[model samples]
Target: MNDYLVKAVAYQNQIRAYAVNSTATVAEAQRRHAAKPTATDALGRSMTAGVILGAMLKGEEKVSVKINGGGPLGTIMVDSNAKGEVRGYVSHPQTEMEINEVGKAVGMNGLLTVSKDVGLMHPFVGQIPLISGEIGEDYTSYLSKSEQTASAVGVDVLVNSDSTVKAAGGFIIQLMPGADEEVLNIIKDRMKVIAPLSSMISEGSTPEQLLEHVLGSENVTVLESMPVRFQCQCSVDRITNAIISLGSEEIQDMIETDGHAEANCHFCNEFYYFDTEHLQALKEVAL
Candidate 1:
C-alpha cells in the first residue's frame, strides 16, 4: 500500500496521536542513498517521526530533524512539511552493521535537534541530548523536554536480508494538558502490551490499525488522513538560482576553469550539471 499518515484523538480528545506507514517512503530513501541495514533503520525511524511531527503543523509550516549520535552512522537529517512530504539522508549511508543495532550504530553521545519553520522571522529550534540513540526514544525525550509535552514515541524499521526495507513506520502519542491520571495510566498500560511496531508493520497493519492497537479501537477517533511520501524540494532551478547568487565572477571562473559545473543535492542524490554554455547564461543573469 502507498505510504500515509493518520491523525487522531483518543479518550474523548484527551490524547493526541499520530501514526504513519512509511514503508515506501523509506524504501525510496534507502534506494537513493544506498543505505545499509543499520543506516536504513536509523534514517527510516527518524524520517517516520519527522513526518508525523510535520503533520502537527498547519499551512506551510515544516519541521527539520537532525541527529548526530557520535557513531558510525554519522548524521541523519530529515525534513518534512505539513503537506505530508518528507525527505532525508544519512551522512554515512554505506555504514555496515547488523540489523536492529541502530542504537549502537548511532551511539549515545550526541544530540537530536528539531527546528520548526512556521513562517516566522526565525525558526524555532530545540535541542536535547540523546537519551538512547534509538530514534524513537530520542524523539520522546525531545518532545517532553523541548516541547514540554508528555509524549510516547515508537518508531521501527525492519530490514530484509538483502538490505531493503521490509517495513518502516511509527506512532506518536501525546497527552493533552488537561488529561487525567486515569487516562495516562490506561495509555501506559496499553503501550506495555502492544506488539512490536516492526512486527505490526510487516504484517500489513495500516496507520489507523496501529493507532487502534495502542489507543484502543473504541477510544481512537480518526481526525485526518493524508498520503505521505519521499519528496525532495530540490530542483535544477533552485540550484541555478543558488549559482546565480554567487556573482558573475564566480560563474565566469567556473566557465574558464572547469568547462562545466556540477552540483549534487545531499537530500535526493540528484546531480545538476551546467555545461560551459549554461554557465555563460547564468553569468549574464548574475550581471
Candidate 2:
C-alpha cells in the first residue's frame, strides 16, 4: 500500500494525535541512500516522525529535523512540508549493528534539533539533548522540553536481512493543556499494552489501526488523511540558477578546469551534469 498519514483527536479534543504508514516512503529513502540496517532504522524513524509533524502545519509551512548522536551513523536529517512530502539522509549510510543495539548504534551523546519555517523572518528553532539516542524517545523529549507539550512518540522500522525495509510506521500522541489526569492515565495504560509500531506495521496495521491501538478505537476521531511520499525540491533549473548566482568568473573557471560540472543532491541523490557548452551558456547569462 502507498504511504499515508492520519490526523486525529481523542478525548473530546484534549488529546491530539498523528499516525502514519511510512513503509514505501522509507523504502524509497533506503534505496536512494543505500543505507544499511542501522542507518535505515534511524533514517526511517526520523522521516516517519517528521512527516507527521509536518502535517501539523498549514499552507507552505515546513519543518526540518536533525539528529546527531555522535555514533557511527553520524547525522540524520529529515525535511517535510505540510503537504505530506518528506525527504531525508543519513551521513553514514553503511552503519550497521545488532538488532537490539539501537541505543549503541545511535549513541546518546549528542543533540536533536528541530527548525520550523512558518514564513517568518526567522524560523523557530528547538534543541534538546539526546537522552536515549533512540529516535522515538529523543523526539518525545524534544516535544516535552522544547515544544512544551507532553507527548508520547513511538517510531520504529523493521529491516530485512538484505537491508530493505520490511515495515515502517509510528504514532505521536500529545496531551493538550488542561488534559485531565484520568485521560492521561488511560492513554498511558493503553500504550503500555500496544505492540511496537514496527511489529504492528509488519502485521499490516493501517495508520488508523495504529492510533486506535494507542488511543482506543472508540475514542479517536479521524480528522484528515493524506498521502505521503519521498520528495525533494532540487531540480536542474534550481541548480542552474545557483550556478548562475556564482557569477561569470566561477562559471568560466568551471568551463576551463573541469569541462563539466556535476551536482548531486543530498536529499534525493539526483545528479545534474552541466557540460562545457552548458557552462558557457550559463556564463553568458551570469552578470
RMSD to the true structure for each prediction, in A, is: 1.1, 1.1
The TM-score that candidate 2 achieves is 0.97
Q: Give the TM-score of candidate 1.
A: 0.97
TM-score of each: 0.97, 0.97
Q: Which stretches of candidate 2 lie over 4 Å from their true place?
A: none
Q: Compute the lDDT for candidate 1.
A: 0.93
List the global CA lDDT of all models: 0.93, 0.92
Error of 2 at 200 (Å): 1.4
Between which residue pairs do clashes occur in model 2? Answer: none
Q: Tens-digit lDDT track for model 2 on 28-70?
A: 9999999998889989999999998999999999999999989
